[model samples]
Target chain A: MSESAAPGIDTAFPLSPEMRAAIIAHARREAPRECCGIIAGRDGAPVRVYPTTNIAEGNRFYEIDPKELADLEFRELPNENAEIVAIYHSHPASPAYPSRTDVELAFWPEAVYLICSLEDPDKPYIRGFTIRDGQIAEVTLPA
Target chain B: MASESTVQVLIPTPLRRFTDGESRVEVSGATVGDALDALEARFPGIDERVRDDSGQIRRFVNLFVNGQNVRDRDGIATPLSPGDELGIIPAMAGGSAA
Candidate 1:
């Protein structure tokens, strides 16, 4: 009854309607401040979005609460046999490209980094990329 | 003699390649430093990345035991229990654009 990202079957990283709305809404609700969260998946396909609190100091930064991160990575994910396939965040004023800081702080080589840009509040957009070894490859998402 | 105990280490994504893509690994040691040494013995190239030339944790890397930072405790000398979980995370932050 619902559509999701099917890895090999889809050319772009697909966000289910619910997930797409959730992320966009979160970005708007936390407008002028960045938000962080994770998207869990099974078999390399995304299934659910688990939004997390941002612990950083400013609107330009986002940090997942360590305890929250631990809980998802250590407990909930394993219980469902799911892995963190994507790490999503919002950019209050910048474009949705991995910033130098984003690339430097990207530790999960296996997970795609999703950035929602609120630069144009009325016409906000989302983009995904893989940041590994200080390099970024943009991930195309369905328009 | 401190009895050799096996503690679990949670490997971060970047270092998973050295761990054969394993997220968690069990190694035997009486203390955290010993455990890291054991990891190097088993996996090779692990301890060095974790502990630098001076044998201290790298500037941007963090090691947590049971959700607590080792630096807040006793550095590498922190003792391990039978089922302790050690988490490795690289420091993540952003610098204001100039």
Candidate 2:
């Protein structure tokens, strides 16, 4: 009945310090609005942050840079060192929550979907989710 | 005014601190915006958490009512009745250099 009904992909990686920093930095840089990016990793450690532009403009939505995503995938594939483990974005003015469009467009159940909310810009809220067949389940971060 | 059949609103962990750790809350409104407004009124600073200076929904945030995304319905204009559950989820990102 829904697109998320499709099978999920794999996203069992942990957030490295570098990966966490990148996301926090992006959120800060895009203050008053939202910022988005991707994480590539393997063996459960995020290694890189591929920053993507949010083409949604003023709306509360996002569209990844196709060219950048493609390039990142291409570059990572050769080394066999990294794979897309997670996709991330910020909530400039609200709490971090998956929207309806997010569920409908979620094609990767295996990849962690991370969100950062600027509800308290000084201390943003971060979360992870796994969407499968339109069902969303929260994932707890490792302490 | 919201009808008696609208859904319940669930505040995520991050926002729960502001809401006294109450994960799920109940509110009534005919539209999503109305429900949010009601939430803001009940919980101060909540409006600021979800909207920008221009009063628009922030990017990277998603609102789901009854397991359905409000974006697909009508965004702030999405209709609401009693007995529904609303979820507020945030987007996450970041990584260290190798």
Top candidate when judged by TM-score against the true structure:
1
For candidate 2, write residues A15-54 as lDDT tens digits: 6666767787898897665677877765555667788876
lDDT of 1 by residue, A51-133 (tens): 98887887777777666676677667888998777888888788888888888787676677888888888878888877767
User: Estimated TM-score per prediction?
Assistant: 0.85, 0.52
Kindly report which residue stretches of model 2 are placed more than 4 angstroms away from their true locations once superposed.
Answer: A1-13, B1-98
**Model 1 per-residue lDDT at A135:** 73
Residue A33 C-alpha lDDT in model 1: 82
Model 1 CA deviation exceeding 4 Å by range: A1-11, B1-3, B91-98
True contacts kept of 2: 0.01
Candidate 1 has a TM-score of 0.85
What value does the lDDT take at residue B32 in candidate 1? 87
Clashing pairs in 1: none
Q: What local lDDT score does residue A97 receive in model 1, on the 0 to 100 scale?
A: 83
